[model samples]
Target: MKLVVQVKLLPTPVQAAALAMTLRACNAAAEYTSRVAYERNVKSRNELQKLCYREIKERFGLSAQPAVRVVKKVVDAYTALHSGIRAGTLGGERSRRRVKAESKPIAFRASAAQPFDDRCLSWRHDASTVSIWTVAGRLKDIRFAGSADQLATLRAHRRGESDLLFRDGMWFLIATCEVPEPEVFEPTDWIGVDRGIVNLATTSDVDNFQGRRLRRHRRWHARKRAELQAKQTKSANRLLKKRARKEARHATCVNHRIANDIVAVAQRTGRGIALEELRGIRDRVRLHRHQRATQSSWPFHQLERHIAYKARRVGVPVLLVDARYTSQTCPRCKHTARSNRPTRDTFSCRRCGLAGPADVVAAVNIRDRARRAWALVNVPVSMAA
Candidate 1:
C-alpha cells in the first residue's frame, strides 16, 4: 500500500527566502507553459517539455530538473482537467461550471506545491535534515521534524517524488512511502458500520460514535465566520481562512479516532469490516434548503477512507455491501417499508414488532449482507457444476 508521511521543515530565514522564491518562479513558469499549451493545443508531456524547457530555464532561471518538473506540472494540470470533464465531475457539457472551466487555461496559485525528484531533493534521515535545490542555490542542512513512526516509515519505505508546500505560515514535505501489506486472515465474523450525519457512525455491535459535539463545534465556527464576514476587513478575511483550516483539522482528528477504534475492535475479534457503498450519496438523497449546508459539509467519505486504509494496514478485509433499504428493512421480520423507520433514529417492524435504534439496525443488516456476500465469493467453482 502507498501512503504519505508529512514532515515539517524548520528552515533558516535565508533558506526560507530561497524556497519562497523558487516556488514562485516554478509556478510562474508553469503558468507560462500552460498558456503556450493552451494556445498550441498541446497536452503531451514530452512535446510540451520540448517547447517550454528552454524558456523555463532561461526566463525563469530554473535548473534542468526544475525546468522539466515545471513543464510536466503544466501537462498534468490539463490532464486532470480533462479527466474531471470526462468523469462528469465538473458537470455536464452545457453546465455553467463546465463551461467556465473549459473557457480558460488552467491557473496555478502563487504558493502552490511543487514536486521535487531525487535529483532536486535528498533526505538525510539520520541527521533529520534535507538538501534541496533552490533557484538561489542548493540549500544544505535544513532541519525537519516528524513523529517517530513517520520517520521510521520514511526511512524504510519512502520512494518517488516529494511535494514541497507552504501552508498556514509553515512549510511541509509530503513524501510517498510504499509499505508492504500483511496477508489477510480468514475472518471469524464481520463488523458492519453504518454512517450517518447525526451519529457519524454506528456499528452492528451497538457502539455509537456521536456527532453532537462536532455539530456544536461547527455551529460555533459558522457563527464566527458570519461575524468575520460582516466586518469586511483584510484581517477578518485572513482569520476566516485560518479558521476554516482549523475546523478541518479538528474534523480529521475526530475521524482518525473513530476509525482507529473501529479497526482495533475488528482486528481483536478476528473479524472483517463491512461498510455500505455510498458512492454519489449526495446525488441519491434529497435535502431541504436549510439542510444543504450541513449535509454537504459533513466528511462521510473521509471517515470511510480512514477505516479502509487502517483495515488494510492490519490485514483486515473490508467489504462494501448494498446500501438500499438498510435503514427501512426489519432485521428480525425481514419486513421492508418506510414505515419501519417512523423517525430518524427509531426503527420498529410492524409485522414482528422488532424495535431498536435505526442506525444499529442498518448496521446489522449490512453485517448480514456481508456474511452472505463473502460466502458466495469464496465458494469453489466445481461444487455443483
Candidate 2:
C-alpha cells in the first residue's frame, strides 16, 4: 500500500532558495507535461507516451517532483474518459463536473517531481536513499520527525534525488515510505457518519464523535474574501494570497484533527465506520453568497479519504454506501417515506415521531446503511447486531 508520511525540512537560507527554484520548475514542468500528455494521448499508445515523457525529461531540465504525478493524473483522466466512452460507463461528452477545477491558483513547486525508489513491486526501503540530491555537496541540518523504520520507508521514493527551487523562500526534498498493509478484519462496532454544511460531520454510532461546522469561522473568511475581490492592486492581491494560505492551512488542520479523532474513537470502541458516497456535491451545492464564499469550503470528501487510509493503518475499515434517502428516511421505523429536512440543524421524522437533533438521527441511519452495504459487498461483516 502507498503510505505517505510528510517530514518537515528546515533548510539553511541558501538551501531554501534552491528548494524554491526547484518547486517553481516542478510546477511548470507539471503543467507542461499535463498539456503534452493530453495531446500525446491522441497520437500514441500509453507505452510510447511514457517513453516520450522520459526522453523529454532527459532532454529538458524539467524534473520537478510533481510533474510525473500530475501528468500521470492527466493521462489517467484522459484515458478513463476515452475508455469509459468505449465501454459505456458514460455516454456522450464528459460531464463538466468531472473536470478537476483547481480551487487554488496553479503554480508548480520544485519538490513536485520527487521520484520513488520502487517500481511496481518490492520493499521500498531496501532500494536505498534516492530522494535527496545535494548540489554544492554536503548541505544543512535536515532532521526526520519519525522513527528509523519510517525514515527507511521515506527513502523508497528517492532512489535518485534531485534539487528543486520555489519562488517563495523554501526548499524541500520529497520522500516516500511504503507501509505494508496490515491484516484487515471485520469490526464489531458499526459507526455511521453524517457530513453536512451546518456541522462538518457527526457519527451515528459514536456518542462523542461529532464534527463541528466551519460555517461561522468560514463566514469570517467570506468578508475578507469580499474585500479581496474588489481591488486589483498588487498589495491587495498579495494580502488575498496571504489570507488564502492561512485559511487553507486552518482548514487542513481542522480536517486532520477531526479525521484523527474519528478514527481514534473507532479504534477505541472497536467499530467500523460508514460514510455516504457523496457525488457532485461541489456542483449540487446551492449557488448563494455564502456558498460562493469559497469553492473548496466542502472538505467532506477530503476528510473521508483521509479517514479511510488512516483507519486502515489500525484495521478500522470504512464503507462508502449510497447516500440516497440516508438523510430523509426514518431510521427507527425503517421508513423509506420522504420528509423535508427544512433546516440544516433540525431532524424530524414523519413516520415515527422520532424527534431529536437531525444530525444525530442521520448519523445513526448512516451507520445502519453501512452495515447493510457491507453485507451486500460480502466483505467480512464489521458491525455487531
Candidate 3:
C-alpha cells in the first residue's frame, strides 16, 4: 500500500553552490557536535551541553534542520552509552580517552523549494518539511516534493525516512520504503528469477531480466574509477567528482529500465514473481577468485529489492521459495543428489537420467514452488492438490 516513487532532480549553478554550502555547514556542525559529546562523556559538562547547538549555529551558520541532526546524533551516542551501562554491557573503567581526530560525520542539507518550482525537488508537510536543490543544470539533479499530501505520505512510512549525506559527489539519503504484501492477484502464473554475476538477472518469464553473458565492465568501470582516483589538481578532482555523479546517474537509469522491464514481464504473465531464497549465494560462490571478482561486480541485492518494490506497485506478489537443493534436486525426477548438478552451470538427475542447463533446472524448481504456493494460498479460487 505504501511505496516511494523517486524521480531525478535538476539544479542550476546557484542552487548547486547553495547545496555545497549546506553540506559544508553540516560537516562542520557534525564535527562540532560530536566533539562536544566526546568531551562531555569523557567528563560531565552540564554548562557546555546546554548551548551546543547555538554555538554550532553561530559558528557554522548551518540551517536549523542540519544543526538539529547533529545535536540528535550527539545525544543519541550518550543515550546508547547509558543504555549499555544499565544492560551491563558497558564498563566504566574504559581505556585512556584517546581522542579520535573527529572528522565530520557524513552530512548533507536539503533546501527543498516549493512544489511548482522546476529547479527544485520539493516535499513539504505538516509533520516534516523537505526540499531538494541541485547543482548547476548539468549535475546533482534531485527531486523536491512540496505538497501537504507528500509530507503526510512520507510520515506514514518510517522506512522511507532518510539521513541525508553528501558523498561521492551528488547528495544521497539513506532512505527506505515498505513493500506491502499484495491482497489481490490473478494467482495463476509465477515469475522465476535466475541471478548471475555477468547478466545481473534472468527471470524465467520469456524475457531475460538480464542476459547471462558475464558483462565484465571491469575495464570500463576501472577506467572511470581510475580517472576518479587519479586526481592530482583541484580542478581535476572537481571534474572527476562531476564524472562520478554522471556515471552513477547512468547506472541508476539502466537499473531502473531493467527493473521496470521485469515488472512488465510479470504483469504480462498474469501472476506473481518467484525467486529462490538464496540467503548468501555470494558466500557459496565467494571462495574462487573468478567468482569472487564476479560477485563484487554483481548487484544482486539491488535487483531483488527493485523487483520486490516494483511488484508491490503493480499489485502483484513476490514469492521467495526455499532454495536449498533447488539447484541439485531434479525437476523431473525429484531426486536430491549431488550428481544431479554435475557442474556449476549444468543440472542432471542421476536417478532419472535427466540433464539440462543448471539455471533452467533451478528456474523450473522455483517455478513449481511458486505455482504450488499460489494454488495453496488461494485455495478458495485455485485448484489445489
Candidate 4:
C-alpha cells in the first residue's frame, strides 16, 4: 500500500527563501520545457529529454537532480495529454468541435512543486532535520516535525520520491511510504453498512452515525461562502478559499472518526464489511435544485474509501455489492418494488408486511449479497470437509 505522510518543516529565514527560489526556478524550467516540447511535438520522455534537458540546466542555473526533475514533470504532462487524446477526450475530430483550442500547451503555475530524488534530499536523525539541495548551490538543513505515528513511518518504511510543497505560508515535505498489506481473512460472516446523507452510516447491527451535526456545519459553510461570493471583493474571495480548505479538513477528520468506528464494530464482531457500490450515483439520481447541493456535498465516497482502508489495515475484508434495489427491496420476503420505500427513512413491504428503517433494511440486504458473493469465491472449510 502506498501512503503519503506530511512532515512540517521549520526553516530559517535564509533557508526558506532559498527553498522558495528553488521552487520558482524549478517550476519556471518545467513551464519552459513543456512549451518547447508542445511546440516541437515531442511525445516521448526520451524525445523530450534529448530536446530540452541541457537548455533547462543552463537557463535555470539548477543542479543535475532538479534539472532532471523538471524534464520529468514536463514529460508527464505530455503523456497525460496523449492519453486523453487516445481516450477521445482531447485533440481529436470528436473534441475539435467541443473544444476550440486544441494546440494549447501545458502550463505550470509558479507555485508548482519540485520533485526530489534521494540524491538531492537527506535526513539527519541526530538533529531531526532534513537537508535539501536548493538553488543556493548548497544543501540547506530544515528542521521538521510530525506525529509519532508519522515519524515512525519515516524511520521505518519511507520510500520513493518526496515533493516539496508550499501552502498557506508554510513548507511541507510529503514523503511516500510503502506499508505491508494485512493478511487476508477467512470468511466467517459479513456485516452490512448503509451510507447516506441523513445518517452518515448505518450497520446491519443497528448502529447509526448521525450526520445532523455535519449537515449543519456544511450548511453554515455554504451560507458563508454564498455571502462572500456575492461581495466579489478580493479579501472575501481569499477568505472563501480559506474556508474551503478548512471545511475539507474538518470533513476529513469527521470521516476518519466515523470510519474508525465502523471498522471497530466489524472487527469486534469478527465479520467482514459489506457496502453498496455507489459509483456514479450522483449522475444516476436526479434531485430538486435545493436538494442537489446538499446531496452533492455528501461525503459518501470519502467515507467509503476511509472504511475500506481502515478495514484492510485490520485484516477485515470489505466488499461492494450491487445497490440497485437494496433500499426498496424487502430483506424479509424478498419483495421488490418502489412502493416499499414510501418514505426516505421508512421501508414498508407490501407483500410480506415487513417494515423497518429504510437504511437498515438496505444494510441487511447488502450483508446477504456479500455473503453470497463470498460463498461463490470461497467454499467454507466445513462444507469442504
Candidate 5:
C-alpha cells in the first residue's frame, strides 16, 4: 500500500526565503506552460515540454529537472481536468460548472506545491536534514522533524517523489511510502458499522461513536465564521480560512481515533469489517434548509477511508454492502417498511413487534448481509457443476 508521510521543516530565514522564491518560480513556470498548452492545444507531456522547456529555464531561472517538473505538472492538470469531464464529475455538458471549467485555461496558485525527485532532493535520515534544489541555489542542512514512527517509515519505504508545500507560514514535505500488506486471515465473524449524522458510527456490537461533541464544535465554528463574514474585511477573510483549517484538523483527528479503535477491535476478535456502500449519497437524499450544512459537511467518507486503510494494514477484510433499507428493515422478523423506523433513533418492527435502537439494528442487518455475500463469494466453484 502507498502512504504519505509529512514532516515539518525548520529553516533559517534565508533558507525560507529561498524556498518561497523557488516555489513561486516553479508555479509561475507552470502557469506559463499551461497557457501555452491551452493556446496550442497541446496535451502530450513530451510535446508540451518541447515547446516550453527552453523558455521556462531561461525565464524562471530553473534548472533542467525543475523545468521538466513544471511542464509535467501542467500536463497532469490538463489530464485530470479532461478525466473529470469524461467521468461526469464536473456535471453534465450544459451544467454551469462544466462550461465554466471548459471556458478558461487552467491557473496555478503562486504557492502551489512542487514535486521534487531524488535527482533534486536528497534526504539525510541520520542527521534529520535534507538538501534540496532551490532557485537561489542548492540548500543543504535544512532541518526537519516528525514522529518516530513516521521517520522510521520514511527511512524504510520512502520512494518516488516528494511534494514541497507552504501552508499557514509553515513548510512541509510530503513523501510517498510503499508498505507491505499482511496476508488476510479467515474471519471468525463480521463487525458491521452503521454511519449516521447523530451517532457518527454504531457497530453491530452496540459500540457507539457519538457526534454530539463534534456537532457542538462545528456550531461554534459556524457562529465565528458568520461573525467574520459580517465584518467583510481582508483580515476577517484570512481569519476565516485559518478557522476552517483548524476545524478540519479537529475532525480529522476525531476520525483517526474512531477508526483506530474500530480496527483494533476487528483485529483482536478476528472479525472482518462491513460498511455500507454510500457512493452518490448526496444526490440520493433530500434535505431541509437547516439540515443541509450538517449533512454535507459530515466527514463520513473520511472515517470510512481511515477504517479501510487501517484494516488493510492489519489483514482485516472489509466488505461493502448495499445501504438501502438498512435502517428501515427489521433484523429479527425480516419485515421491511418505512414505518418500522418511527423516529431517527428508534426501530419497531411493524409485523413481529421487535424493537431496538435503529442504528444497532441497521448494523446487525449489515453484518448479516456481509455473511451471506462473503459465503457466495468464497464458495467452491466446482461443488455442483
Candidate 6:
C-alpha cells in the first residue's frame, strides 16, 4: 500500500530561499529538457537522457542527479501525452500538430522532485531535520514537523521518491511510504452498504452514518464562496482558496471516521463490504438545478475510496454491486418499480406490504447482490452465506 505523509518544513530564511532557488533551477532544467525533447522528437526517457543530459548540466549548472530527474520528468510528460492521444481523450490530429508547433518550454512552480536513490536527500529522525541539495550547494539540518502519527510512519516506513512542495508561504515535504498489505479474507457473509447524499452510508444490518451535518456544512461553504466571489477582490480570492482547503480537510476527516466505523462493523461481523457501483450515476439520473449542484457536491466517490482502502487495510474485502434499482427494489417481496420508492428517504412496494427506509432497503439489496454474485463465482459454500 502507498501512503503519503506531508511534513511542514521549518526552514530558516536562508534555507528557505536556497530551497526555492533549487526548485526553480530544477524547473528550469525541466523546461529546457522538455523543449529539447519536443524539438528532437525524443520519445523515450533513454533517448531524452542521451540527447539532453550533458547539455542540461552545462546550461543549468546542475549536478548529474537533478539533471536526470528533470529529463525523466519531461519524458514522463510526453509519455502521458502519448497515452492521452492513444485513448482518444486528446485529439490525435490536433495533438500531433501542436507537438510539432510547440516551441516554448512548460513552466513549473513551487515544486521539486527528489529521487530516493540520490545522495542529495537525507533525513535525521532524532532531530526532525532533513538535508537537501540546493542551487547554493546543499542545505543541511532543515527542521521539519508533522503530526505524531505522520512522524512515526516516516520513521518506520518511508520509501522511494518524495516531492518538495511550496504553497501559501510554507514549504512541505511530501513523502510516500510503503505499508504492508492486509491478509486476504474468505468472508462467510457480506454486509451491504448504501451511499447517498443525505446519509453518507447505510448498512444492511440497519446501521447508518448520517450526512446531514456535512450537507449543511457544504451549503454554508457554497454560500460563503458565492459571497466572496461577488466581491471580486484579491483578499476574497485568497479566502476562497483557504476555504476550499478547509472544506476538503473537514470532508476528509469525516470520511476517515465514517470509513473506519463501517470497516469496523464489517470486521466485527466477519463479513465483506458490498457497495454500489456509482460510476456515471449523475449522468444516469436527471435532477433539477439545485439538486444537481447538491448531488455534484456530494463526496460519494471520496467516501467510497476511503471505505475501499480502509477495508483492504483491515483484511475486509469490498465489492461493487450493480446499483440499478437498488433503492426502488423491495427487499421483502423482490418487487422492483419506480413507484416502489414513494419518497427519497422512504421505500414502499405497491405490490407488497414491504416498507422501510429507502437507503436501508438499497443496502439490503446490495448485500444480497454481492452474496449471490460471490456464490456464483466461488466453489466453497463456507465462504458464502
Give the best candidate by TM-score: 5
lDDT of each: 0.95, 0.60, 0.59, 0.86, 0.95, 0.85
**Candidate 1, residues 46-87: lDDT per residue as tens digits?**
999889999999999999999998988888889999999999
Clashing pairs in 1: none
> What ranking of all candidate models by TM-score puts the best one first?
5, 1, 4, 6, 2, 3
Candidate 1 regions exceeding 4 Å error are 231-237
Q: Which candidate, 1 or 3, would have the higher lDDT against the true structure?
A: 1
Model 2 spans > 4 angstroms off: 17-168, 206-213, 281-296, 336-343, 379-385
Candidate 2: deviation at residue 316, Å? 1.8
Comparing 5 and 6 on lDDT, the stronger one:
5
lDDT of 3 at 163: 46
- What lDDT tens digits, residue by residue, belong to model 5 across residues 1-385? 9999999999999999999999999999999999999999998999999999999999999999999999988999999999999999999999999999888899999999999999999999999999999999999999999999999999999999999999999999999999999999899889999999899999999999999998999999999999999999999999999999999999999999999999999999999999999998889888899999898897889999999999998899999999999999988778899999999999999999999999999999999999999998888989725
Whole-model alpha-carbon lDDT for candidate 2? 0.60
Order of models, best lDDT first: 5, 1, 4, 6, 2, 3
* Per-model tally of clashing residue pairs: 0, 28, 16, 0, 0, 0
Instruction: Tell me the tens digit of each residue's lDDT in model 6 across 92-211.
Output: 565765555343454554365534333768999999999988879888899999999999989899997777888777989989989788796999999999988888889999998898
Q: Which ten residues in a row have the lowest lDDT in candidate 6?
A: 109-118
**By TM-score, is 2 or 4 better?**
4
Cα error, residue 362 of model 1, in Å, equals 1.4
Model 4: per-residue lDDT, tens digit, 1-385?
8878899999999988988998999999988898888798877777788888898889989877788888888888777766776777655665663254355778887877778988999877568899899889665568999998888878778898889999889999999988878896875799998888899889998999899998889989989999999999999999999999999999899899989988888888788999999998888888889888787876779989999888887899999999889999988889999999999999999998999999999999999999999887788778878
Tens-digit lDDT string for candidate 2 (1-385):
6665444455657765554554454455555655555544442445535644674466445443333544554455556655765665544345443333212223334455433222311222443222333323233344324467556566554333222322233433344445666777778858888876656778885354333446667778879878887987888888888888887788788777878888988989888988888877657656777556454565667888888888988888888877777777778887765463556566677776776677777888888887877776775466542
Q: Compared to the true structure, candidate 4 yields what TM-score?
A: 0.91
* Model 4 weakest lDDT span, ten residues long: 94-103
